[model samples]
Target: MSTTRTHPVAGRATEVPPRSRTSPPSRRRSSRTRDRLAAAAFLTPLLAYLALFYAFPLFRNLDLSVRGYTVRNFVQGGAPFIGFDNYVKVFTSQTFVPALTHTAVFTLVSIAFQFAVGLALAVFFHSSFRLSATLRALFLVPWLLPLIVSASTWSWMLNSDSGVVNSLLRAVGVDPVNWLTDPNMALVSVLVANIWIGIPFNLVILYSGLQNIPKDLYEAAALDGATAWQTFWRVTFPLLRPVSAIVILLGLVYTLKVFDIIWIMTRGGPAGSSTTLATWTYQLGFGSLLPNFGPAAAVGNILIVLALLAGLAYIRLQRRQEA
Candidate 1:
């Protein structure tokens, strides 16, 4: 071959160019950027909504708590910037302490009953039985019903006169106690109504969790000579832990803020015995035939702090589990 010898450039003569480390890494970086942008685009509306509605109102409420103006006008005495006087009142007021105690007892009892009953129902519906689909839909009806209507219906049912509960009690040869009127019974009445309302929600969530469980896990457990209880505790319960956490957290939050049922059922009545933080706040600030905003704001502020703490705890727990 007739040779064409072109001399290499001076600096490059003895050394070849190192490979450029840019294109693939640059493409990967661009891909990641696009993914993050896509994710942010999806999240934009939710963030905007929270900022506008929840965050703004929360700050406004915090502002109301510290504003020293409301005390300038209490009828019994002037509202003072007693810095946290409102909170102090919430703890010490005869009504507040008992009401809080009642709320704690009510929430614990009702949640336990609802969870047990709901879990049973979920098991019932998890089977491939006739009307399973129809039954699942039926179970959620209580959840779908309007709150006021449910409360009203429950009130009517528990009425001392002309109500189903009383009629049944009479049939059982027990006196038709003042289910809603008696101070001893009113909180229980409220608890009953709450349980009725809460059951459907628990059923839905637990049932959904049951459905998400893999069939193969159960099959494997069975093949290992495991009893049903063993399989459930070892496999099913472990799998259900995340969903159960969600259910418990939400149940506490909802139960703590519960108002409509108690409000309609008892109106915080029979001596303000059945009041919760939410209802007490309403009574203090706005539930009066004439409203007082300062203490009400204070009560509301306490609830906000508690709920915020609960939410933060949940977030931390979730992060720890994820990590």
Candidate 2:
């Protein structure tokens, strides 16, 4: 005899249909297709932007770098294909070595001092105190102002003759020092200005990172009889590494491309003492009557490489921390 099975519904037995093995896979495939379409729709704008603004410009610049692009090319709408001749010219140029060295020094010194000052301020503000918020807001003024304005203000302050810095030094019985005129001092002056502008950015980021850290960790450190400095080094600093790495990488990229402060203060002057690769590119492209667009593009590509390496480093660090 054959047996029959039924499912109960509303206190009555009803015949039920057998399950189909094919249904679930078909449903899942449709759901996945819908999800993929949704994702692609959301990402389309951003992808388009990157392709239009970033990727296209980068490739166009690369093409220009390999060709004899110049002001004449701008007029005639045609450029000769030179195939890395611009790169050769840039490497062989007298300004290349000094500009490269200045770029390195400026980036390193600005990042180091900015991080140190910013970290100190972040730690100080991390503790509850009166007027702390007000003070921190005040600190942001330098960073908040437009770069041109900040650079101009610094130029006035650091003026060799009648500037406030010189006035103060004179009042203290020291002879007025040439901050912008001396080749030895121009780069240092630019560094000082850049550091000042950069500190608030670092402080804001580091302070936010400090806030995210668990209070329980500090309590645990205290229970372990760790001194404040020991607790900071062992507990806080280690936890802060990821944020610090990000901050440093961002700072490095910003510093590498710094132009406004140096340009306003000295125009990379005093015998090209403060000329970074960025400014050198500017000089090649616009400073002279004959614009060397090819070499300028080559220099720009060099900066892009450095930035890309820094970005890669940041990605690697993040992955390692996640692992």
Give lDDT per model, in order.
0.82, 0.93
Model 1 CA deviation exceeding 4 Å by range: 1-47, 68-82, 319-323
lDDT of 2: 0.93
| RMSD each, Å | 6.5, 3.3
User: Which residue pairs clash in candidate 1?
Assistant: 71-79
Model 2: how far is 16 from its true place, Å? 11
Shift of residue 316 alpha carbon in model 1, Å: 4.1
Clashes per candidate, residues 3 or more apart or on different chains: 1, 0
TM-score, predicted candidate 2 vs. hidden true structure:
0.91
How do all models score by TM-score? 0.81, 0.91
| Cα deviation of 89, candidate 2, in Å | 0.8
Candidate number achieving the greatest TM-score relative to the actual structure: 2
Residue 265 of model 2, lDDT score: 94
Lowest summed lDDT window (length 10), candidate 1: 1-10
